[model samples]
Structures are given as C-alpha cells and as structure tokens.
Target: MNTDVLVVGAGPTGLALGIDLARRGVDALVVEKADRLFPGSRGKGIQPRTMEVFDDLGVLDAILAVGGTYPVGMVWQDGERVGEHRMFDPAEPTEDSPYNAPWMVPQWRTQEVLFARLVELGGRVAFGREVVGFERADQEADGVTVRFAAGPDVRARYVVAADGGRSVVRRTLGIGMTGETVDPNPLLVADTRITGLDRDNWHIFPPRGEHAGYLSICPLAGTEDFQVVAQFPEGTRVDLSAEAIRAVVAARSHLAPESVTEVRWASDFRPRAALADRFRSGRVFLAGDAAHVHSPAGGQGLNTSVQDAYNLGWKLGAVLRGGAPAALLGTYEEERRPVAGQMLGISTGVHRGEVRRGEATRQLGLGYRESSLTEETRTAPAGLCAGDRAPDGKLAGVRLFDAFRGPHWTLVAVGVEAPELPESVRVVTGDEQPSYGKGLFLVRPDGYVGWAGEDTSRLADYLDRGVTR
Candidate 1:
C-alpha cells in the first residue's frame, strides 16, 4: 500500500494527526501494533491549550461531554482525614482565555474520542500492523518503504513515528535520546474500582514508613473507576496483580482489601525525562512520546504530544495537499523541540515538588515566538504578538474562533487597515479587540500568530513566500 503519510501508532498523537490530515484531504494511514486502542487511564489531565486544539479539531464538545473538571484533593494520614489539597492553582475564565483549568478525562477515553472523530472523517487505522523497520535508497529521498511484522510493506512520501518513547522507527533510524532518570523509584498506575472511597475528592495517602511511598486514588471523571498511583522505593519490583493492588490499597489507606473491587488495567514505569536528539530523520518525523518522554508530572506528556501532532499536522497538509514547499516541514523541529525541552523541565520540577501546577501546566502561555516562520513586523505592539496564540473573542458579530475553525488561515485585522489576501486566507475584520491592539495578525492553521504588522505590505510578502502557496 502507498500513502502520502504513514503514521505509526494509534495512540492519541497518531490518531489526532490522522484526524487533522484526513480533514485536510491528505492521504494518511494510521497503524497500530496492538489490536485495539490503549485501555489505560494514564495522562488523564487535559490542559486548556489542548482543549483549544480539540475545539478546532471538532471534538471539543464530545470531549467536554465525556469529561469533567478536576475534583479537590483530600489528604489522609494514619486513616484520619486531613486538610484539602488543590492539585492546580485556580484561575478565572476571561474573554480571551475561556478554559481556565484542566479537564479530567481518562486517557483511554480521550483516545476513543479521537478515534471516533477520525473514523467520522473517513480516516483509516489498521490494527496488528507493526513497523519493524523502513528503507530508502537515499537519506533524503522521495519515499520510504516501511516494513511491517505481519503485512506488506507500505510506501509513503513521509512517515511520522508517533509510536511512542521506545519508538521503533526512531531507534531503527539510529536517533539517540538524551535524558536522565527523574526519579529512581518505580511507580505503578492502575484503573481500579473501589467501594468505600467517596468520589467527591481525590484521596491521597501519605507514606507512613521509610519503605512505603505515597499513594493517591483519584476518581475518574464520567466513569466509576478511580486511577490509583503508588510509588515504590528504588530497586523494588512492582507486582501488577489484582491481589497486589488490593494489598497496596489496604496497607496505605484505610480501605480494606475488599475495597479494590476491580483492577481493570495497570502498568508500571520509572519516572524519566528524555528527548530525541532530532525530530526528523529524512522522510520520517518523530512526534509525541516518540520525540520526547516526560516524567508525567504536571500532566505535560500527553498535552505536549497532542500539540506536537497539532503543530505537524497542518504543516504536512500544506506541503502535501496545499502546494507548499517541503522545506516548510523543517520548522516543525525548530518550533517544537524547544517547547518540548521546557515542558520536560516543568514536568521534572513538578515531580520534585519544585514547581506548581499553575499557568505553566495550563500551557496557554506556550508559543513559537522565536520560530523562523514568525514575523513580528510591529515596532511597538500591545497584548498579543507574533508567534502568540490567537485569543478567542467576539467582534463585529463574528466569533474569532468560529472564523479560525477548520483547516484554514485567518487574518485578524483589529483596528488596522486590511490586506488583499489570497482566497485561501480567511480574513476577519474587526474595529477593536482588547487582546489584539491595532495591528494585522496572520494566524497560522495551528492557531499561532505567524505574522504581525501595522501595514498590509509585509503581510502579502509573508503569505506569498511559500506560506500560503
């Protein structure tokens, strides 16, 4: 089989990318080694920035329907209730930033939501198709032949290794990863059902002895299951059996062995933060956990991964389906790697209790200010700038997000003159916007401000220079 792009792995990253590509009429294939989507509740916190990406992807309503706001954390020690703990700092919604907090949705359910959206767009994901390796005559070649473990090799002009941290494609391409172990202790995470715990708050059990570590049980929003996290000292093997889980709950919290009624899915991993040395290897590009692995603290891993896909999907669509230069793909690494590095530090700091899950964890502040694609032509601007996220607001009876929705470019002319843009670049003219002050903003398909200026002369030049070709 042949395709324009072959996306490995059907996790959230691959599925989200496939959905974006499919909607743009790009011929893409998503394949998975496993027979079904991931069944765990890992990476459950959906940051506000990611929620914006979902809104553009046509899955925000469904995501909101299947998820709820995070509950307050209730602490316990020696079987006695203690004070409440807020996992994230509170922020009020504003006219520009509506989503102020993380939404609690099980990772598995998030994947299901994405998969359903992809299927709705007629995207295909083949299961049981494992990529063992890939081949190309030249390093910078036209196509790559990806060999599978159980099926015919597929050819693609570009390949994305969203296969995850232990990415077979990345390793096969000999890309080295640079990172360190964030925590020496091993941790266990499981989706379980408990009997005695109230679903109103996240139940926390502090370590009582030197040998024991912290344990927390958080009620999974929109479901009966509670996600259980337990830490063990270094060099100790974790038992994933139901009995071990029950015993752990009985020993740490006041809950008895019978409280853990069901252990649906469980996994163990040591906390670590790693990043691939390079995101692209010739025809293949690394995204999601394939590009960077986080400590899972402050819930940055999956959110970063989804944004990685969000950033790449539009660029790929531009090159393959919208007559853009292939060099447009180069900016993906330039824009995402630094963001990945920053998120890694945030995750590690949060893991070590040195950082708070506040504005940083929300991820709304992240942007590509230094990217080569960004052109800050304004001498002195206020509020939003080039390489910043285009804020959502209503102006002249038009919602900015409503205009920015779908796979298209948006030119927000707020209290400024207009430009003669191509038919592809949709223009939203407004007299005033508090977030945008007297400038022409060229918003990329991924919602980042690509160009900003006081005049329309440079706007056309930026768009004509292979940006909107």
Candidate 2:
C-alpha cells in the first residue's frame, strides 16, 4: 500500500484528519482537486465545542490568536441606526467549558492554519489530483486501489471522502444523500472591503418593502474585511460580480457603491440540509460535507465536520498501530451519524426561526451515551458518565487537559486508588477533582469518557478491547 490512509479533498476535514493521523505517526496522504487552499470566508463561525477539539489538535492557541468573538448586531433603517441586535444568547465560561461564545474566523484563515499545522507535522497534500474511481481489495484484509485523474493509481489500507457536498467519491460509491432545501431564495455571500462600515458591529438592514430583501455585513475579526450576505427572491439569477454586489449594497443599505472598495471573493448558494445514507462503504468512508450538509444559519457545518475528523482519526490510529480489530472502526459511523442528524435539525431550525442559537447550537452538551463503546459499569454514577466529555481540571498538580493533550488514552483516578495500567495508557491520580466527584474515568484519545466505574476490575478488559501491550 502506498499509504495507510488516503484522505480526499484538502478542506478543513481533510487537513484536520491529516494532522491527527500525522501526530500518531500514521502513513496518510491528503489530496485536493483545487490548486490552492480555499480563499473565501465561507464558514466563519466557530462554535464552543469545536474550540475544545482545536485545543486537543494543538491549534487552539493559533485559532484564538487569529479570531475574535462575534460582534453585536446593529440594525439600520433609512440610513440611520435603529437599534442593537444580539446574534446569540448570552453564556459565560465555566470550568468545564473554557470557550463560552462563538468565535469569528474566516473559513479561509482556518484552512490556512490547519494546512500549516499539517505541514509542520510532516504531512503532505497533493494538489490538482482528483479521484476518478476506486476498487476495493478482493480480500477483506487487503487494501484498496484508487485511480486518480492526473496521476498513477495508488493503494491504501483505507480511503476517506472529505470532499464537499458534490463528492465524487461518494457518488462513485453509489451512496445517496437525503435532504431538503431549507430556503428556496438564493443567498449571495462574499468577502469584501467596505469603507463606510464600522468593524465593531454586524450591520443589518431589514427588508424595506415587498420588493427588497434584507442585507447583512459583518466584520471578519482580526482582518480588514467584512462578509456580505444578501438574500434574493426565488428564481433570481443572483449575479456574483463586483458591480452586482455593490449595487445590492447601495440599494439595500446606506452605503454607496463607491464605499465598496473591493470584492475579494464571492459565491451564491441555496440554503439546504442533507445527510448521506451511509457513512462507510467497505474500505471507503465519508466525512464533512460528504457525510452531511448544513445551512450556514447556525454555523454547525464546519464545526461538525471538524469533530467528524477528530472522532475517526483516533480510531484509525488504534486499528493501524495498536493491534485493535477492524470491527472497532465501525463505531465511527455509529457514533457520528446521529450527531450529524441532530446538528442538521438544529441548523434547519435556526434557518427557519424555529430554534434559537442557544445551548443546542453551542454543541457543548453533545455526547455518545448510546454508543456500544461506552461502558457505564457503576450502578449509580455521579458527575460524569461513560460517553460524556471529560471536563478539564487540575489533578495532582497537573492539568487534566495537559495529561490528555497527547495521542494516548488517559486513566484518570479521581478520589480513588489508581490501578496498575498498561504502558500504552497514561495515568493521572488525584484525591479529588471538582468536576469529577469520585470515580475512575478512562478518557479516550478523542477526549470522551469511554469507561467509568468505582473500581478497576473492568479496566483491563476495556483496554484489551482496543489497546495493545
């Protein structure tokens, strides 16, 4: 095999997966059809849960440096300031959740950061290479052969389709996507430099009459740019040219055409939500937009896609390097499919005004309680349970996150006698931790509690399920 894993498309999902695999010393390759990274601020809002994922991936510091909190929305009418609008409900940071609010970073900047990190980790992305077709190995234990449009065929133990909604690998594998259009009206989104707008507020212009639609201009944090989103009636051609965008801005808001200095990037799309019928097909797996597509209203698309990569990365590492059985990989689809479905509903709801961007949109409460991988052995569990996110705290003069930072399972003994764990697993012992009352928590590499109990009788068996001695 040319590599252990062949990740298609160099978007956020592919780059994130590449970074995760590279840190584990896995032989992986990322291929992109585009000549360069994405250039637009398409997915600008990063939710709080995704912030935690970024922390583990070692890019949280950079993300925080390049992004800022979402600005308060300012309403305008007849070229005058009308009132102030709040984009999200208020929330404060807690011990369990450090990032409390949504962060604003242009999607282009996020990709650039992930790409640089991937390169730093010794991972490579081959550009201008598109996958035309692929064939599975004749035997279940063998690898798959992938045919590219511009290069020789390559073989890999597994392939992941991180391509966008119009995924060629998914289509080639005959996987169907089921979804409905969230909004029939076309929306034009672009990144531009405007002179008349202030960077402190997200400017909003309500619809003037039956003929005119609403327009919003938000300052992209940490940069001299603004993201313009304008709605159009159904059946409109929705021109994306510079002149068309300037005309829209002038007609809908107080900004004159001359105030729009330059159009850096632009695109138009109809808001829609979709999910693939299946996430895995034999040796090929679907992730990011290939697995599910969400409307941009709630900012769940990119965050969910990044978590998908995070979930699959550790499992792939375990099976490839830790002597785990291949069936362990099936848990990825089982755990993430439901999450994609739930997030899709939330995105669609936020787009239709049926749900507010509140706790659900933050995604901090998401868990894998129903997965077969979770083992809640205790009859009465306190504080945390199997499948819940292991909260960060100080234990025995060491930070729990610091202990869980690297690519290894952490057996956290809080207010309990520690066990003699295998060398493959890292152990953290303490007399007490506030977030975790008094129990043994086995934190998975992905930062989820895989097993929790009052004793160590079942710990070894759980380790034998995946970890090698």
Candidate 3:
C-alpha cells in the first residue's frame, strides 16, 4: 500500500492536517491505533486563534454551534455559595479580532467535528492500524516505508507522528524529551452526571487542609455531563474507578456520594512539561503531543498542537503539489518549536499561578517575526507588520477573512497599487484599512503576514526564490 503523506493518530492534530491537505487536493492517510476516536474530554478549551484557524478550515460554524463560552467560577465553602469570579478576563469582540474569548468544546466532540469535516473532503482514516516502526527508505527511494503491527507496510513521501506523548514513531526516531514536573501533585479528571450542581457557573472548592489539593467541577458546554477535576498530594496513588470519583466529590465538596449519578469517563496524570529534542527527523516529522507535552493549564496543549498541523499542512501541500523547495519544510520545526516552548512556559505559569488566563492565553500575539521566510522591507513600518497574524476586518465592502479563505496566499495591498501576481495569490486592495496603515502585506495560507513592505520588489523576490506554485 502507498500514500503521499502518512499521518498517524486520529486526534485533533492528525484530523486537522488531513482536512487541510484534502482541501488542497493532497493525498493524506490518517491511521489510528485504536478502533475508534478518543472518548474523553481532556483538551476542552479552544483558544481564539484556533477558532480563526477553524473558520478557514470550514469547521468554525459547526464548532461554534456545538460549543459555548466558558462560565464564571463560583467559589464555595461548607456547602454555602460564596462570591463568584471570572475564570478568564473578558474581552469584547473588535473588528480585527472577532473571536476574543475562550470557547468550551470537549476534546472528543472537537475531534468528531474535525473528522466529519475530513470525511466530507474525501479524506481517509484507517483504524486499528498501529504503527510499529518505520522501514527506513534508501536515499534513492524518495520516501519512507512505515510498518504496522498487523497490516502490510505502507510507503509514503512523508510521515507525520501525531501519535501523542507516548509516540511510538517519535521513540523509534530516538528523539529525547527534556523538562520538569510542573507540580508535584497528581490530578484526577472525570466526566460525570451529577445532581445538585447548577449549569451556570464553574464550582470551585478550596482546600480544607494544609496539604490537601483543590477541587473543581465545571459544566461541560453543550452536554449534560460535568467535568470534575481533583488534585492529590505528591506520590499519592490516584484511582480512576467510578466509586473513587464519587468519594472524591463527596469528600471535597458538599455533593453526596449518591449525587454523582454516573461516571462517563475518568483518567489520572501528573502535571509535567516536556518538549521533544527535535520535531523533524529525515522524512518523518513530529507534531502535537509527540513534539511537546504541556500541562493542560490555560488550555495551550491542544490549541498549540492543532496549530502545529495548520503550520505544517500548507508547507506540505506547497511542496507536494506546488513547485516549492523542501527547505520550506525545515521552517516547520524552526517556527513551531519556539512557539511550543513559549506555550509550555505559559501552561506551566498558569498552573503555578504565575500567569493569568487572558491575552497571553488567547495566543493571538504569537508570530514568526524572525523566521527566515519573513521579509520586512519597509523602512518605517506601521500598524501591521511582517510575520504578524492577519487580523480580520472589512476592506472595501469585502471581509478580509472571506478574501483570505481557501488554499491560497493573499496580498493585502492597502492604500497602494495592487500588482499583478500568480493565480495562486489572492489580491485584496483597500484604500484604507484601519488596522493596517498603507503597506503591501503578503498573507500566508495559514493567515500570517509572511512579507510586508511598500514596494512589490520584496514580495516578488520572496515568491521567486522562497515560494512558488
């Protein structure tokens, strides 16, 4: 068997990459070790920047339809309702940034939505096909051969290891993860059907003892189940049984053991931050949890993982279908690894009370200003600059996001003459864009400003030497 790109794991990262490649008419095959999709609600918080990515991927409407904004946190003590506080700093939607708040959609439902979109685009996923190792391809082969535990070997032009933190492919490549434990305690997370809990606010229980940990029960949006999280002291053996979950809820909060009607799913893990030594090794690339594992604080792990796929998908499409050089692939690691490191720090800080869940957690400020691909030619740049995220707004009776949609680059020629370019690049001209002062901006397919300058020479040179169709 053969495929153009082989993607392991069917989580958000793999499914998203499959959708992007499918839209670009790239042949991508996603294989999962399990028989079905992940059934837990682990990564539930979807940041604002990821919402924009989903909008471009055609799943924004579905995601928004099924998800709701995060609720306020209500502190409780001795069964009495205390004062309430905001979980995240509220930000009103501006013309340039529409989705400014964090949305809540369980990790399971998010993956399901992405999988449905991938299927709609004619993408394929083979389940129960666990990747054992890679049958190293010769220099003349031009691709790698992947071996499975039970199925025949499959060859591909490139392999992406989205297999998760316990990534078999990453381990086979001999990549090392270096980091420290964010907290010395272990946390037990579960989805449960409980009585006596309002769906309006996230219930929080402060620690009663000096060594005791905290407890939180958040109403999972768009569902009847509540996500229960409880922390335990270091070296404590955490049990995942339904009975244990009920005991923890009863002991920590005012809820009775019988109030926990049912436990839908449960898991336990210690908070830790780790990053792979490298994201790419030869034709194989590591993405998502396989590349960096973050403490689920501030909801950075899954969002960062999905963006990793978003960043790599277009480059893969450009190299495979378009006439771009393979060196473009190297930028995936260079650009994403640093972003991953920053997100890891943010996650750790949020876990330890060193960072707040506001603009820093929104991820809109992340960029590639120093990337080799970015070219800032303007002597005195203003407002929007190179390598910044292309903000969303109206430009001369047209929406910038609408113009930037689809698998193509966009040239936002604001207050300047629009130049003739290849069909691969979409040009949007506006006399004045409030967010962007007079300038020519080259927006990449992933919606980041790749080149910014008043003159078209930098844009022409970038396309001629660095990018092409």
lDDT of each: 0.93, 0.91, 0.93
In candidate 2, what are the lDDT values of residues 389-426, reduced to their tens digit? 88887898888888999788898998899888888789
lDDT of 3 by residue, 201-244 (tens): 99999998988889999999999989999999999999999999
What residue pairs are clashing in model 2?
A: none
RMSD of each: 0.8, 1.3, 1.0
lDDT of 3 at 274: 98
Query: Considering only N, C-alpha and C atoms within 3 Å, which residue pairs clash in candidate 3?
Result: none
- TM-score per candidate: 0.99, 0.98, 0.99
Model 3: CA > 4 A from native? 137-141
**What is the model-wide C-alpha lDDT for candidate 1?**
0.93
Tell me the deviation in Å of residue 277 in model 2.
0.6
User: Model 2, poorest ten-residue lDDT window?
Assistant: 135-144
